[model samples]
Target: MADTVFFVTKASGKQEAFDLGKLQHSLKRAGAPPSAMPEIEEAVQKMLYPGISTREIYRKAFSLLRKASPHMAARYKLKKAIMELGPSGFPFEKYVGKLLDFEGYDTQVGKIVQGHCVPHEIDVIALKDEQHFMIECKYHSEQNRKCDVKIPLYIHARFLDVEKMWQQRPGHDHKFHQGWIVTNTRFTDAAIQYGNCAGLRLISWNYPRKESLKKRIDRSGLHPLTCLTTLTKKEKQQLLDQGLVLCRELHRDLNQLRSVGVSEARLKKVEQEVRLLCEPESPIL
Candidate 1:
């Protein structure tokens, strides 16, 4: 019943009431067709128990969406796909660099820079139009982990050190510089507060209201290669290792798939999926 109160278990081991609105909203955002909503809602509701895991619910919705459109299912899988970007986090850093590059910013990933206090490894450095950003990526494999205040605290201190030296460089007298913390998870309230007070920009999965990381990815249409449902886990990891992080890369060169010994038939299916994924969507007017 829509009026029924049922709790769901989150990945963090916490239980909270499930809201159908949230589910429907996420489905819509994934481009799930309106016609499919009633069936998905009814099915998911039927499966609800005292403490059904959120992950299970997600799987049910994803399975249904895949049947309707694999591309849409891929979009729904974006969050988990991002987590799949690593145990090392390098792929995610490189992925962020690519997103910045798509926006016309010259970007570097995994660079060592000398800070005023010490040498620091910046996850990503983006420059455009006399503006410089020293970005530190905080990647978590777990969905429920939140970036706490200590993260922003440490990042701000490191950024201050790096910015000091950066500002001293020639031709940077008037350039604007900033320190940013980008994470795949949500930020703790304290963490966001510290970042705001310290002038460090914090970008999380849903933070900053309108300009969150998810929004940026959707706006840019730069879905990660891991989002493809057509590829197996090993195949995706192999491409990531070879520096192919975006679906656009595979679309541009199917040889990358072949290099991994993907048969011609499989490659054709992958190509079709890539084509659909990479095709630009018309703007909603």
Candidate 2:
């Protein structure tokens, strides 16, 4: 490999020297075959341009990976596919609840509960053993957008209000409740700081570095239905609109796809891809 002087633009609008190691690492993380590496590298090299966006690089690599292995490609595209779950945040909230459900918690989405000072509408709530958590799901369609400090400030206030209500209610003194803010995109520095200072748990796509939201989703094998490449955009939206949020749900009831007019052949292809992507051992970074 030669020192390629070309620069690659990142999601945050910063440009840096194109690094092959980073590309190789991503492919390896996605479980791409060792043999496919050379071809992928060659395709990327041929398409290189000064200031090419990382998003474009990813799109090119994913296209090549799809031809090689749809399973690996789906794994690689997990983050972007999540962004595709929304023009709205409701589907993302439901998907988050499903991920929590897979992790052995009893989860509920879109519930209205009475707080001490006011009635609050919660996005997702999860209970396990004797502990319960009220979660606020923040979804962003743009990769660069982030959940900021103001979000946690407001959520923490609401949590305090609700906590007061819980404390005042008899017999509820034995129960523990926590506030969590979960997002599809990353959180800002100030947001993480505020969350930590206020004792509110913050979960974001890449926050906490090693154990990120993406890692959690991958580890649980609860990928959303939008991750499927076999289906067209319209078909994916149709499934989402029909309340099919998780890929595992679609896997369990594949007739849902058939009902939405996907060809029988394509339905089977989607089923196979979903199964492989949601398997227990899918790798994550």
TM-score of each: 0.95, 0.94
How many clashes (backbone N, Cα, C below 3 Å) per candidate?
A: 0, 0
* Runs in model 2 lying further than 4 Å from the true structure: 282-285
Q: Write the per-residue lDDT of candidate 1 for residues 1-285, one digit (tens) a residue.
A: 777899999998999999999899888888888888889989999999989999999999999988888888898899999999997999999988998898899999999999988999999999999999999999999998999999999999999899999989999879999999999989999999899999999999888878888888988889999999989999998998898889999888899999988899888888988889898874321
List CA RMSD, all candidates. 1.6, 1.7
Cα-based lDDT for every prediction: 0.91, 0.87
Off by over 4 Å in 1: 282-285
Query: Candidate 1 deviates by what RMSD?
Result: 1.6
Minimum summed lDDT over a 10-residue window in model 1 is located at 276-285
Which TM-score value belongs to model 2?
A: 0.94
